[model samples]
Target: MKKLIKKNIVIATHEYATGFPQHLRSYLSDHSSGNVLYIHHPLHPELREGIGSGYEWNSGKKRISSRSTRPVTAFGIAFFMKSLFLDIWWTLKSGKRWDAYIGVNNLNALAGVVLQKFGMVKKSIYYTVDFIPHRFSNTFLNAMYLWIDKLCVKQCDETWILSPRIREGRHRVLHIPSSYDRKQIEVPEGIWLSRIKQAPFSSVSPHTGVFVGVLLERMGLQLVLQAMPKILKKIPDFRLIVIGKGAYEHELKRLITQLGIQKSVECKGYVEKFSDVEKIVARCAVGFAPYTTEKSGLTYFADPAKTKTYLGCSVPVVMTNMFHNACDIE
Candidate 1:
């Protein structure tokens, strides 16, 4: 009898709870019969538990601590070093050579690059989900980040960008070097499509609006809040439902109280399950993706999972012009 070989695959990512990483995990778990090892920097403490064959490094605390400018740059350096050390440690401890190593961001991709160079991993894949030039407040640090990103893209066997806008705008315009031909760089239509539940389209009440995903400053929940009074003028019974949590939660709540629109908005906090989020969104009249254009360059190119989730629930989206899909809404 011939023995079946299980290819060893390693995935290193800074985010695990939501967005691309979560969908990637689900897809790999379902489709691949190989032994998959997930090395993730847990953004949420609750998601520290390993998924599939996985390991967690508490990258969340570092991010939370690095609120200031200097500390943010320091955190980036620390993250790169920590990820590299963890990758080396895992490679040594596992005793099995990795057939492939997939990195979700520049920091994690640095680790994959080193692993591939050392012959610990046969192939490397750099997944570019977001491209923000000024991610770090310090100019030097931001330049360093860009250099690292370029190196990751150049060294990796395959590069996968989330949106066509990014592939066209950043990759083509910036002229990043790649190993493979056109087939090497792939732009997937939707990362979360497999996990999305197919349900009948249900019309929502005109006065209700729903916003789902991470409640960050760039997400433009504040814009939604500011527009609430105007929306109320047109539709007196307008109510907005916010489902997610982030650093901007306190500010959002404060704004709600200050605007005297507390009764008109409901902050659902973080829903543990995506199914629950879908349930809440399904009852709303329109889905909101009011991302701020000035906040980040990545916003213009990002294929936000929240948009997909909203559409999956059959909710009409009211997003800003920054998003690539926003043009298609009309």
Candidate 2:
């Protein structure tokens, strides 16, 4: 039998509405035992008011003490600079050298590579949670993003991708060669039910459809909402449920009102618990993920969590194949 070895791992990443870093933190705690350091960066620095420090550090149940930064009021370029500074500064002061530094996005991953230069980490893992050819509308910004992506790919000891299709993008689009190891795609773990409980609702109809996750326009939920009228005509009492909220909420509500299909649609804006989401999806007939393939969107290359969530519930998904892990889901 092979002897099991343990190593301390450090994870540096931003926290978005999706709560990806939190999920990852939980997963690591449950699966591994070395001294794991999780650094939480500000999601929106521009919104964080006046000298407040959004940068935080945690290892298991213990919190590391650090002074907060006067968050930059300006977003975009300024925010990127802030994120880079925080990533390096905190890791440098974290007291112990990490065996592996896992950075979730390209920017954070680039920070890990830099730390490897300063001898702070033995291995730097560029863990890409999302990928897209044209991530920014601005040509220069998009080019810069790709440049950093490639830099991280080459500098990091290993690149941990969520989907294999990301390799295709790296080769054909970003031009990274195939010689690099193509293993280590962390397929999301299976769900472990905390408690056997039904969704708060009475009973969901078989004709009902559900969409869950951060409500982004790129998700293509509008397409389903626009077509709900035609769907109701044929299927009778066919209803569609929107189970999250985002910047698109107002637009969704406006369109629902305009289409006069308000009666057939239920917008259940952001249910807080994962168990609640699980229960709701399990009872639904189908899950919608009609991603907007017309343009460059993060979902095109990221292994979407909702797809797994739906399948976990035994609910079939209706999604775009442009996604990186779409084939696996199929």
Candidate 3:
């Protein structure tokens, strides 16, 4: 057997516990030869140091404790402003030139480009998860976001997108033509080998379903709750297990109580590992991913990661036609 050659690689993304970043890390660990450094931008302003908050750093197999960010507002404007600067600053301070620098979101991608400018990174990759023009409510902020997105697309050495529709949308909406075609656009899709191994056989709960995704309103989780009352009438012992956390979690719980389905539905908050999610989902009869079809939402363009995870678990997935893979699901 030949020995694997190591590459110095770094990744920057928001500390969201979404499967994408973790999957990226796990995928590289298994296939690529590299020393990986992962950095995160905290979503909330009140992230603490020791609580395993998403803002911490992990390099290779070792976990490195990082200092906490100062508080301000939700989504923390300061974090957004400083994320790119710090990525470059940290790279320069390391006194090392990275073989590849991958940034998950547009802001992080911009950091990768800036690192390349400073000669700190050999290659800069723009790994965009989703793209929507009206992502922010503020007009100025939304415009700025779009500008940064276009800049990253033009500047980065490579752009890794989730779906092909996103590629079309960028050209149609942003008027940015694809220069390299196949070389420029790449889709890194695949669950881990264990997920590919398929979940173990278990006693399926016929009247029970599981939800393992973000709790965002556009994710359409509330619709399932609204319809659950009717579902309860059919299967009196019907149950729903909701795993994952997001902005809509409070509203979801409130709606559950409002619908008087508290005993019927269980909110498991956030699960740290997809394997743990599989443990809960594999035992269920079906999985749910009722995302909305709103044009301004990420669901309209990108395939839902939760739905893919559910499919990997070998459980039936009930999803809306708002995502890219809806037509293919059948």
Candidate 4:
């Protein structure tokens, strides 16, 4: 038997201890022999205790959670700049030469480019999980984000996209010639290793549905609220469990109140633990991922994590037709 050699890897991401990056960190820690340095954002006071505070390093697992000490609005330009600088500084100051540098978003991808350019990293991989151009409200910001995104895709050794639609858009629509290879890796919201073990808990109730993702207007949550009355007419006890928070939260709450379905709807806000999310999904009869068809809509050209999480927990999913893989569900 031959022992596999470990490769040194560094990951730069803005999301701190959540989503695909967290899953990737766990995977690398368990699989690799070399140390994995995860550069993440600062934690909130609640998340600052027990495995959340400071750096968490196991026998071979090492992570560096760094960012601006001052409070900044989440996903704002200031936050992005602060996170970028911290990641760049730590990546350079680590002293250890990384075999592979992986960046999870646009800002981190730019940092990865700098690391590669400066010879600090042998190879750079851009893990583009979302399209950022449509995320910005300002035109100049959107244009700037697109430019940086293109540069990262063109210069990185490998580009890993979350969906096939994004790849098509990059090649045929965008016509951005990539100097490197591109791969589509669909990273689900939460990993489910033992579906059978969890299946027994996934009891279906026709009157209940679950929506487990960011509560954004682009997510077509309004449509869900609009249809709630119709759903209630058919199933009087129809309940909607919303298990995430975002910019559209206030609007969603107002709509729920206006529609008089507030009693039937339960907003769980944000669940930090993936296990807790799965447990909630398991009890629901169906899952909702009603992404819109707008140009900025994520489902128009991406694999939604909520859809996968629903199916992973053996709950039937109700999503829009725009989702590329939605037809395959039946």
Query: Best candidate, TM-score-wise?
Result: 3
Clashes of each: 0, 1, 0, 0
Model 3 lDDT, full chain set: 0.75
Candidates sorted by lDDT, descending order? 3, 2, 4, 1
State TM-scores per candidate.
Answer: 0.81, 0.83, 0.88, 0.85
Candidate 2 lDDT tens digits, 1-330: 011125677778875444456665666665555566776665544333353334445454455554566655666686777788878888887778888888888999989989999999998988888778988989999999999999888888878777666777788888787676453455442444443354433565689899997676888899999888889889978988888777777888999999999888988875757777888888888999888885355776677778877776778899888776677788
* lDDT tens digits, residue span 41-103, model 1: 544433233322236321212211111111112234664576567766675566667888888
The per-residue C-alpha lDDT of model 3 at residue 278 equals 72
| lDDT (C-alpha, whole model) for all candidates | 0.69, 0.74, 0.75, 0.71
Query: In candidate 4, how many Å is residue 73 off?
Result: 4.5
**How does model 1 fare in lDDT?**
0.69
Model 4: colliding residue pairs: none
- Tens digit of per-residue lDDT, candidate 3, span 126-235: 88788886888998888888899889888888888888777877887788877734534747355655655454555778889998776788989998999999999989
The collision pairs in model 1 are none
Choose 1 or 4, whichever is better by lDDT: 4
lDDT of 1 at 163: 68
Q: Which of the two candidates, 1 or 2, achieves a greater TM-score against the reference?
A: 2
> Which candidate order results from sorting by TM-score in descending order?
3, 4, 2, 1
Prediction 2 global C-alpha lDDT: 0.74
